[model samples]
Target: MKSKSFKRYFILLYPFLMLITLVLVALISNISLNDILMAAAKPLTSPFYRLSFIKEFLIVGLLSVAMNLSLSMGEMNFSLEGIFHMAVFLSALVAIYFANFFIIIVLVPIVLYFLWQVPKKVSRGDGNKLIISSLIFNYLILGAINYLVYTFFSDENISSAVTKDFAFALDMKLGVAIAVASLVAFIIFAVKTSLVTKLKIIKDAPSILTSTGTEIKKEKRAIDLCLTLLTSVAAFLYLFLNYNRFSLQSFTGYGFDAITVTLLARGDFKKLAYPAILITYIRLLSLVMQTEFSFVSSVMYLMQGVLIFISILEARDDRNY
Candidate 1:
């Protein structure tokens, strides 16, 4: 029984183990103690970088929870990446040309409403269709957005636009408050609500719920809206915090990163914070390494792959037990 419990909670320990591995790797790479200390202290020493990281943590955390909630019901919304990016991009463009910061208040809902309709019309409550349609939509949307950015915006124009009030629409204190509240609210919705029980039934035995007159598609559409709302807010907060340093090439692949975090949490919303913190730590560390130690950018991708691999191995072990 003790061993079983250990096995069950081992994922919570995995992040620390990865941290140790990173330390060992640093040592092997001739990183001095002072360099390590400086890297650790860098974000704290720079206010802007620190605020950027805080925003990243909140953004990624919200996305992870949203993804986990959807996956719990056997659906995956890959279009979140598109929605997250496009909403902010459109808002920024409007703010740049029209000089109106509040334009995002209109743009966000419009973009989300458009995206929200795609999966609903295409999938009709089938999880597999939702996955395929969202994935394809994600690619098309991202490609089109990037093309427009590359075509119309020079680097200087992009820089000027980001430096304007558009990015800093919300003061830092208010932004932080909203981000924290959003994450907390979503967690409670996932863990404390009765809707989760219905979602579970839908996951494990959809036919059982269908026989009892449960509307599987309706349940899924509700989850879909919740997810879009979170992603939209996350994108808005991200623009407020990081848009000053944003780039046309600034996609974070966080849509997929959320998947790895969710898998590590083993479908438990209560454990979601652990994996979210773990992924955020890895991201911070990756940035530190790249900027301070001159490490290659691909190091972050490698670390992400390692995390998914470890999660897969643990998942296989669980099945055996």
Candidate 2:
């Protein structure tokens, strides 16, 4: 009986597993893996390069996993992209005015609270409602920024039109390092918290836990809030600090990448880390491919989105084992 049950479960999981394998194979084949490996193995490589890549991969993966976990608990937080852009704007503003680490740290939470609360208020506890409200919020904020940029910050003298003084103090390397450190600290704290532990129990025995009703609801809210706040902070740091370096020229592609990372991890942080790293590498590889072939990058994004959509649908239908 036990063997039959296990076999049945494996059969159900096979297609999903195969899909993941195929994505990996396709991504791997697109890049010059051997050449990249050889380049990395060179003795003259910079320490910053090695450390920054690991830091960036972990931070992005951590944020994606955190957001997915909040969504799993039915928290409507559709403001991630907006919050990310806001974080960049706020960071730039703060860095310009203050340029002190302590001030930025103090302000980050306050900014995140406002960002988190907007969706909570608008959604009135509905996830879909929150998503819609957040999307609207994103556009409104973007328009405001563009207006400000053009009216005051536009250097009539310079071609780019951006204010030179308004740039963020921290670059990609420092931003990624700070984000990775914060993620590590959050993971440590989360492990010690009662909410995650209680959720584990409830997840293990929903019927028994649901009998208590109030306790389960409280535990669920605690977990969702914690995850949402953490993810918001991480995304904010990534977008804010790196925005100037990477063109905010197109956010649609990055937004899709965020969705793919979230789906691939299935809201599990540990599993998310590996996939995040793989996805980042795939993206880097995609850049190389784009230089050689005009349409490969567009094809890569389409493939990623389709795979994630299928994965989410399949996960919804299958019972968690």
Candidate 3:
């Protein structure tokens, strides 16, 4: 029974599947698999590098899990992009003045609690309304953030159109520890607890979930609110490691990789880690290939576009069949 439940959690051998796909991609490009693995293994080969990779993976994994919270509930909270940047911008403003703990305890949560309303306001109805409203509210938040930053901090050197170093930031180690903790908490909440069963109802039988008077809508918003808080906290911590301050640019365009990772994982939390690593590697490879490998970034993106188009075609065919 335990083994069966474990299999259900992990689904197929995802780690092996990722490795095989990676090796095939390497061989097709005529690159030595050893070299590719070695490059990816810099984290293991070097301790400092390992921390960087761990931090990176934890960020990706956390974002994926956060999105899964809402996506599993048949919702997509795009305001996460806004929430992330707003917290990032807000972090710099507050962290520059206060101690690290004060920033984390007071400023971070306060910003998150307010920005949490954006998703609640935007994601009113499901389907296109959800997507469009999310995008709309996301921009609205970005605009407000931009105005506040410009109006208040326009003359301040600590946080303006330029980036500046600051004191009282989370060290990479502590940031990574907190990120791991967040991911673990999310895993327990999503997987080990009964929330998964409720989420399944939302995903597979929304009508039933609604009919049961389960207050699932309230639950869904609460979960999204929690996720927004988590992602914002991590974003604030990331400011300490790098990018202490910057202009109020949109982070909405970011985390597109999370979507890819979540889709590949298919809501299997245990399957999430391997794909997160793979997508992160793909992201890094896209950067690395820009300079050395024969495949330039444009060519890589073109190939990706082609593959995505074919996948869409295949999906359409399956649906029609």
Candidate 4:
């Protein structure tokens, strides 16, 4: 009986053992275990550490949840990336031209609403159509940004270059205001989910609840929005806090990092916060590793990509026949 019990325990432990072995092999072959642990721990207290990655992670996670929710309802809309980039550009432009902190607080949701609504209406409930339309819209926004920057601020100093001074201003009061507003918005949404319609929707479609119509969904969305707003504010604030602020440059890599963290967390915003920090740490460590052990950094990215791919495949297989 004891032997049988031991065998059963071993069966249960098998997958964990495999995972540990894989991690050990990877570390032994490429990076030192100590270095990897240190790299992972660096985010906890990095001088450049900003809580904004948490916000970014939440935003991306919420967006992912929203997309999943819509898809479960038989609606396919993948225009979030486009909407997100557009929102960022528009917010930055607002900060540059008007410098009204409240404007961002008011405008972001409006922009997201329109971004969400247009394709939904045009597609008329066709998932594939909605996706294609969103893709086109994303390209259009990218083109517009290029044209606008080229036309109005074509001079190298004015156009392509970021004004160090202005960047600093964004990081200070303006950043703080954005963070506060985002937090408020998140709280309101979370409180409002107690309404009957949302509960009914959750009852009818549990999966949709996972994405949109549950108490948790509302909480998650609110958290994500708050996190994103805070991140944006913090990033801008960092510029102001430092006198050596550079030009207003978009960090697409950070955006992609947020997406990766969100994907890794599977849209659980609360759970995602810590992982987002880890991701940020990894990003910083990558810089150091790139200089010391170039190939390892590349391998880390490759491994992350593989993990994401495998996750998607497994999720799809589980969901479908």
Candidate 5:
């Protein structure tokens, strides 16, 4: 019975199976017998590469969960771009002054609260309206954030847009530990808790997302706020892990990847982690393939799009709606 129950949920693992298929394709795209042998021995030869993969996955996973919460309500958030920059800058600023990780953590919720209010005011109770408003609002906020980063973070030590690292939260060991704990705890709470049912109900009936006044209450509001804060935290954590330098660019590049991870998860929070890992592999593979096999790398993203679409289709459940 236990094995049967477990097997029933095996379909949820489709993202990973797709990921395996992808890995094979990538390896074959520019195949070499020696490279195949190296790939087989990679784990034994260089275990840190595996660690690097896990670290990237956790970073992507946190941001995906943040998006998943809002997506469950049938809403799209583009504020992730601004959130990534602001969370890192503000958190790094606090770290430089106080040298306390807790301070950075505490400040995230406040920053997110302000960000969360932006959409509520701009959106006219419509999902598409919210997306447009978010794009406008986030870029507006991004301008201010870029200016601040360039002015404050870009000093004499930093000739370009990047800068030196800050301590406290910048430790790789600490970041990895936090990532593991976060992945485990988030999965447990999202799947094993009562909130799972509420999320499922919302996923099945996306209409209720905009049915304002009496149709919604603290339940949905609480989840949205939690997601907003989670997105900010994900940004904060990224800065912690890769605090080597700051990017003053309008976008930090992970916003789309985060969205891809969330969409691939397809409302099943339990399966969210796998999609995050899959995206991480695709991204990392693209980086390697870009230099060695430019043509193959160019097609990597298109391949990922096809796979994510198929995986999401498999996970789609349209019963209640």
Candidate 6:
């Protein structure tokens, strides 16, 4: 009962907490209040800005959906950033020689194969172990990314060859459509399938299920594959939306943000959209800060760390509930 109350209160208080954090960050960074206000108001004040916000929202929104699938099943997939990056980079390479449609064709099988191979090496443990293993997997992907960057990819080749020849606004709209469909599919799967019940048991009482001859490991892998599948589609659409905007500099923090969004929404599919909008707005505000105040990315990361810590606490409380 106490756990339930605390979770409810925390969810209600989260937006205010984020608002306070932003204000504190602004004050500490010596940024102007007016600048922050203007940044917050941009999406509301302009159609182009609104559309741009929605475009960015779709990327992280779909990602949260994907990540939540694994997270709700007691997995924290830090490897999603690596998976998303790999998908975009490899597909962009294929795009150099083939049509965009062919990229989708190639991505699906590659993602499936990668997910298939992942469990062979990294045994799925509990949540913390899953996090550590995912991080390990992520770093491995990063190592490969570094080698590929050195050997194959560059701004000149990627930009001139892979980024053009596509309609940006059209692809953005297509991404939105696909994201809506994914949400519907997620709802049906949750409500209509027995997998949801099985996943709950797998998370809470794996031994009981195993005693009944349930395939716990197989069930977990199935969720992981579903996660990869959703993330792969999101990756391709994200690449289409921001084709020239990426680099091999570092893992884009979109994956981490997605996890945070899912946590903040408490893995509720209906609530996920709300936090996605808020997070995306906060993210855009951070970009504006970067330009206007020379705000450091590390500061934003620190704030996100706090949010994640709190959300993890809430997740723990949920287990108690």
Best model number under TM-score: 6
lDDT of 2 by residue, 156-176 (tens): 565343543645535666766
Global local distance difference test of model 6: 0.67
C-alpha RMSD (angstroms) for model 6: 3.8
lDDT of 3 by residue, 201-301 (tens): 87778789678777866777667666776776567655666544555432332344555455456565566777788666655554443334554333323
Tens-digit per-residue lDDT, 68-167, candidate 4: 3333333334455555555655555665577776887677655666556677678875545665676567567656755665555334654464431233
Instruction: Output the number of the lDDT-best candidate.
Output: 1
Candidate 2: worst-modelled 10 consecutive residues by lDDT: 245-254
Ranking by TM-score: 6, 1, 5, 3, 2, 4
Residue-level lDDT of model 1, residues 87-129, one tens digit each, is 7677667766676756666667666766756864799866556
lDDT of 5 at 148: 70
RMSD of each: 4.5, 6.4, 6.5, 8.1, 6.3, 3.8
* TM-score against truth, every candidate: 0.76, 0.64, 0.68, 0.57, 0.70, 0.82
Q: Give candidate 1 regions above 4 Å deviation.
A: 1-10, 17-30, 41-50, 77-79, 98-110, 113-137, 154-168, 183-193, 242-245, 306-321
From the highest lDDT down, the ranking of the candidates is 1, 6, 5, 3, 2, 4
Local distance difference test scores for all models? 0.68, 0.54, 0.60, 0.49, 0.62, 0.67
Winner on TM-score (1 vs 3): 1
* Clashes per model (N, Cα, C within 3 A): 0, 1, 0, 8, 0, 0
Report the error of model 4 at residue 296, Å: 12
* Candidate 4: stretches off by over 4 Å: 1-46, 49-78, 119-123, 126-140, 158-181, 195-250, 287-320
TM-score of 2: 0.64
Q: What pairs collide in candidate 5?
A: none
Name the runs in model 3 displaced over 4 angstroms. Answer: 1-49, 106-110, 113-123, 139-161, 188-193, 242-254, 287-321
